[model samples]
Target chain A: MKQYKHHTLSVLVENKAGVLSRIAGLFARRGFNIYSLAVAPTDDQKFSQITIVVDVQSAPLEQITKQLFKLINVVKISELDPATSCEYELILAKINAPGNNRASIIELVQLFGGKIVDIGISQLTVMLADSPTKVDDFEALLEPYGIIEVQRTGRVALAKQETSSAKLRSISGKVS
Target chain B: MELTGAQALIKSLEAQGVEVIFGIPGGAILPVYDPLIDSPLRHILVRHEQGAGHMAEGYAHVSGRPGVAMVTSGPAATNIVTALADAYMDSIPMVCITGQVALGSIGTDAFQEADTTGITMSVTKHNWLVTSAQDIPRIIKEAFHVATTGRPGPVLVDIPKDVSNQLMQWYWPDEVDMPGYKPTVKGHPKMIKQAAKLILEAKKPVIYAGGGIIRAGASDQLKTLAELISSPVATTLMGRGCFPDEHELAMGMPGMHGTYTAVTAIQKADLLIALGVRFDDRVTGKISSFAPNAKVIHVDIDPAELGKVRHPEVPIVGDVGYVLTELIKEIKNLEKKQDQSDKSAWLKQIKDWQIRFPLTYDKEQTKVIKPQFVVETLSANTPEDTIVVSGVGQHQMFATQYWKFNRPNQWVNSGGLGTMGFAIPAAIGAKVANPSAMVWAIDGDGCFQMTAQELVTASSEKIPIKVAILNNAYLGMVRQWQEMFYEERYSEVYLSPDLPDYVKWAEAMGCVGFRVESPDEVAIVIEKANAINDRPVVIDFRTDSSEKVYPMVPSGASNDDIVVDPSQGQGGM
Candidate 1:
């Protein structure tokens, strides 16, 4: 059996209505799988950045990027490498806590640089923002405590801004 | 100029040089139709939206320009989806504008409300949902640009009814502002040189051409390339007329229903110089074994198509004509003249195959007329410049196999999608495009029933296209499959020949009707149908249903195991 590899792609598109639908429709019709997707407006008002993690077992990365480029609103697709890019995800969770376990949970949160947003009679709402792996570790650690609810925002990534040296081959998919 | 969006729409169409629009007006699209009455552009009202869409497709197939279609919301928009899909599959240039409900009433389930954009997003190359009246002209420009460029597929623009009613200050932009839609029209010089080297070095080369040759107006360039290289050309079904069948080096259409020489030559080739073809499944039976020893040099305008089916040793992405020009130049510069004797063995092999297994049908059946006979007789009687259109099924295969097409755009059929109801309206549209040329539609009993009502439109419009319905009394292709694979337990495939008297139906549609039961009357009625220049004519030629397309590579089978007529026993092989 062939292993299906997962790749994260950062795409810049003209910010407008139904652009997401167009991208989603392309994926669906082409039978490409979406592992995770994050969409947010860029610093510029006219363009938006979409970070998509795809798991298409049958298609290659070049094919996916080529199909995306066919869409009129899609401007650029950048393949974000985990080795050089900064990838982050946010997780919000409420853990069932008694008064005695509250201090230990707070200590764990402080150690991980997370913040306790609210304290309830029997629960504590914790907010953690970090790399996807770290967020997963945090979720695993909090599973010991009775969990009330959990929410996670899909990953958003950007390439590292480095001026030290430029490499001959960049990580961007196909073309800008 | 200050104008309503509907008025500006007409003006934009006029600016775009769209001479005709095929559509049917309803509540949502009433505003767009209102402006058409005053505009100089002609509008042919169709009975169904599907007919309008197919008519545009046929018009585009013949004229090499983007055909235009407009329809109302909901069912009308949905009805046109088949044509959109068909055009998309064949990469026909078409612009379809569907009217939507008011902006505010959208998603409220108002009357005739449908998510037209969402429904058509997958089928269309690009589509726009216009919210403001000011964006109409720009979107229309972009729609035409997108539909007629790159691979040339259908595009749709869904406008709200209120947006059409609103007034706007209209100014046609000089250039479209689509940053992401720049299509590469020129091949890389280095790649062209590499391809030229491959062409010169190959011992056995086959030029497999597709509809892209006609779309890019590259038939002349392809012919030059084929003749200069001494490579035999095998055209796909959509590429029927690109290479003249009379040319000695021309191999006929290749695939399931292709000629024997074409199928055998491709299998034995050492190199395939594929241009503007996607290597469709029908063409490549069992992809793994298709052209087993061939190193491919694939060129197409669409990048995704280059490696979608068959990966190429030299993948060149550019317009077909431009690539052919560059390739021809590079080949000429690389070598002053191609050594003709280098490929003598390959050429001789193709010639031998052509002589051994010519496309043949039993012509002595006196009780029943073979469908191929009807097609051949029609081919013999029609003018050289006549545009041949066909519906899907066994009739389509026979139409393409028998017709001797020598010029580009002289053959039109639903190649990719195999839309059943395509022939009637498409013939109407083709005749409209080439008013001086005689257009003939060869149809089947099953397919003609799908869009027969469009004859009414053709008759009323005075576009005289003669049609011959091969009354096989069944879905001929499906029945053949059932007989071969499913023990001949024919399921709902039969449509009795005499159920709907086609002559009466033709007469009711204001067309001159003729019924020919025997083969003796075939040529006489065809001559009569040809002479009628004032209105559309229909002739019902009741044909035998048992006759099937020959030289068939059975489903999922390798091209190596192609079967000839079963009656001609397998003992020879």
Candidate 2:
């Protein structure tokens, strides 16, 4: 069997204490090997949501969910399908403006709906809100003007609205 | 809102629990360096920027933490590329920070300027060039996140001198958002079932572990699966020591310089289950000839590695540890014993080959020093917990063959990219990480000479690592090729300069050094080096230049075509 790549996960975790650490510890201990992990407070009642991108094959997500729930703080868990859900990411970049190029840099910033968050004699702070791809495109645009530094947060996503992301999806009946 | 950009970088690093930074000071980076001096972070001054990078990698591999290396722009930044490439290929987490020319001077052929971001984009998982000081706090935070998450790799940040010099308020956000870089963590149920099915159907099965097991901190999971399935497991050189070498199913490393039994078993297996391993050429010799009979099942976290080498019958692109656990669960349910009856035929065949060409060296021989004896002796004295880092060539092969690595993350070498001059600094980094574990740097004459300058770094760091120089006067592997294919017309392979007494060489660097000319002295001096724990030591073992590693499957040749003992048979086409 070739190794499976690209798994979407929803982890229902404890809202208090070291729940994140506990969940991460679980993945580390079980060798569940998560590729991407995004954790945040959920909109619903004091619960936390964790989205995990994993490298795995057709296995039991129930076992992982059940194990996660075993932790006192983790109340529920699920693995989401990215194909069925809308995934989005945000990125920000800082562009350095040479003394002579302030006008051009400002013009370029307006093209992307980015605002100047900070201004210095030698540097111009530019911020952008978009998908990861768009951020990259924006960064590429500022490359000619000379970028002074860059910082980007990786992707984070929520389950589609109206559907409980905590529910586990059934596997291809082969496990039975 | 008051912290300067450089100060913000420090705060972000502190948030990540980084206690040490290795780097060289330069003009363009003086702003960052000035703040760095006052910060609580311990900065290691390395002679070369490249050494700083490798040292960071070494530190990360052993400690399982993302290493940080800082340098100024231009040549200094360029020097660190090799280390970044090594860390990238090996999946070691590292953050490289370089200082660029002032914004106005950039792209104008500014002095000390280099297009570092462009040069390093291909090598790093991601890179950032900061323009404004306001973004410093967020970017530094994000850089660490990117470097350590998912399939870990190096990340680079180039801050312009002016940007570093800029005074702006820094805000450390409790959380930052990025939409583009999501890594997958969960395994698909369908693929896991397919992997399980393959395991149940196959009569002879094996699991090959790579660096990912250690990276994932899934050593225990890997162990559990091997025991559950009752199947043999082999590791890549990097994978060594992750699985206890003493495990009944543990077959050690397999490849061009791997164990005879391990390679042979891999050749005969009907099902090959690979975990977290990229099919590196060293592991799979001649793609067409490698395990032609076996149905390959590849498991890895990175999707790019899935079918890049040999096409797997089942490709499960997930974490190695995760996929194996699921497979173990499935196998436990059926628990079928297809070949419970020992493969006496296969074992006997391997045994005969072992007997025909036992890994040996003459004990009472008069003239030439055998490299095998040095390796064997080093292995005997070195604890199984000790980490062994090796440069490429005969010494590397010998170290691989002789060292009994039973623990994981104990063997580090440049495998995917056979970069020489790797061992010395790597051992330094390992020593820095695992202060208790013995670190043996096995180097050949040629390889050692390339980065011997790093000896100064080892000494200054007080890492106390033992450097075992397998000083065969000639470049043994190259000489063997010249002898086998080119009729022994010794081309430019000879370095006539008297081997610099590495013993004195170590002394020159303010450390102890020893030389072992005889086999009997090998254990004593090695033990002596092991006994001392405060400072690094170098041992120059005089070895025969003509000796070659046997059980050879010359590059593209099949496993069945292995040369068990090349020294005895007449040279033939």
Q: Give the top-scoring candidate (TM-score).
A: 1
The residue-by-residue lDDT of candidate 1 on A42-161, one tens digit each, is: 899999999998885658877898898889899988887777689999999999989889998998898889999998998999999999889999999999998889999989888988
Across residues A10-111, which tens digit of lDDT does each residue of candidate 2 receive? 766546544576667666655567666777777875777777776564334544554454343555555666655556555566677877998988988898
TM-scores of the candidates in the order shown: 0.97, 0.75
Candidate 2 CAPRI assessment class:
incorrect
Candidate 2 lDDT, B340-401, residue by residue in tens: 33444544555564455555555567566688887777787777678888988888888877
Worst 10 residues of 2 chain B by lDDT: B564-573
Instruction: Give fnat for candidate 1.
Output: 0.57
Name the runs in model 2 displaced over 4 angstroms: A1-176, B336-358, B361-367, B497-499, B567-573
The residue pairs in collision within model 1 are: none
Fnat for model 2 comes to: 0.00
- lDDT, each prediction: 0.91, 0.77
lDDT of 1: 0.91
